[model samples]
Target: MKIVVAGATGSLGTQVVEAVRAAGHEPVSISRETGVDLISGVGLTEALRGASAIIDASATSSTSTKASIEFFTTVTRNLLAAERAAGVPHHVAISIIGAAKVNANYYAGKAAQEEILRAEPDGWSLLRTTQFHEFARQLVGHGKLGPFQGVPQMRSQPVAATEVAAELVAIASGDPRGIEPELAGPQEEKMSDLVRRYLAATGQRRPVIELSIPGAWGRGMRDGSLLPKAGTRRGRQTFDEWLATQSR
Candidate 1:
């Protein structure tokens, strides 16, 4: 099968591309970095020419709600339009476990994408996965106080991106089943504790403090809205196991 991996250079996108290739499929790498701007529809038609499946893992780092929503909605609309024109069989998206439930600006963008895909004519599959184990590293300097790095007051069942990538490839090769089962790590963990353990594992000296962010987004995080529910698939790599393998 011919597969198009949007955002092919991102953390999960890179792995998804490799996974597709390893499974004996032709993987087409697409991203702004690769000269394919998903938001503007530039190079979309050409990139999706012979694609049988498309995995949309593209994302922006923008925190602005309007900008994020525009970017996500535009990209999703363009991809679906191109897929319809190109006769693509499946549209697969990588989504967070509680994208719709959480009120984070980023989660709002994901939810918008999901809504767009749900209405599209093509066969669509939205795979909601838990936070990536590497999320700990991302949080290291994100939420900060006065000279102190702080973590968000949240819980997550973070799984490895590699494991999620493998599952995405498996889903891409199979028939679309609408929203698939959620994927999560072996155990639930506090976000702050995870980051602290991650720093310790890497021999870093940063103290990770926990902070309560105000809003529905923060409330959702604190109340377990980001966790995978029962009957979801779980990966084997624990945070400690993942931390142990990191060189830094």
Candidate 2:
């Protein structure tokens, strides 16, 4: 199987690409570094040519509402169109769990991506997974004041990125299962607690203060609206297990 991996250089993307190769498939690395920009549709057709499946792990760090929505929407549409034209059989997209429920700007972008993919005529599988364990680091670094880091008051089942990538590859290599089971970690945890544990393990002394996000999105996050419902498949690793690996 020939697999086209968008965002091939990212943390999760890198793992997906490696997993694909390890599964005895050819992985075409697609990203700006490889002259393929899904946002602008640059080199997309060529990159997807002769590919049997596409795993979209692309992402941006932008927080601006307009930019985030635009980026995800445009990239998703471009990828779907290209996959259709290229006669790709399976299109697998990774989305955050509770994207629609959260209603945050970033989650809004992901919701848009999901909508676009779901509407595609080609076979598509959208796997919505909970936050990665590394999200603890993202929370601490996404915003920083002079003396404190802003951590949202939220609950999550943070899975390992490698585990997420493994599932993605399994989906890509097999038949497309539309809107498959939601994936989550083994245990529920608070964002603040995970960050505190991560900091302690890393020997960093940054004070983390929880703030109530001032929107429906924030409320949803803090209220556990984004958690995976019962019957969802759970990953084996816990946040603590993922954190422990960092010290190794």
Q: Highest lDDT: which candidate?
A: 1
Residue 7 accuracy (lDDT) in model 2? 95
Tens digits of per-residue lDDT for model 2 on 1-248? 99999999987899899999888999999989999888788799998999989999999898656777898999888888898899898989999888876656788888778888777665999888999988888777675767887788998988888989889989988888888788998889999889888888988888888988878778878888878898889999888878878972
Q: Clashing pairs in model 2?
A: none
lDDT of 1: 0.87
lDDT per residue, candidate 1, 69-177, as tens digits?
8889998888888998999989999888887887467788888888887886559998888999988887774655666678889989999988999889899999988
TM-score of 1: 0.93
TM-score of 2: 0.94
lDDT of 2 at 190: 92
Off by over 4 Å in 2: none
**Model 2 lowest lDDT segment of ten:** 138-147
The residue-level lDDT of candidate 1 at 136 comes to 85
Model 2 per-residue lDDT at 165: 89
Model 1 is weakest, by summed lDDT over 10 consecutive residues, at: 139-148
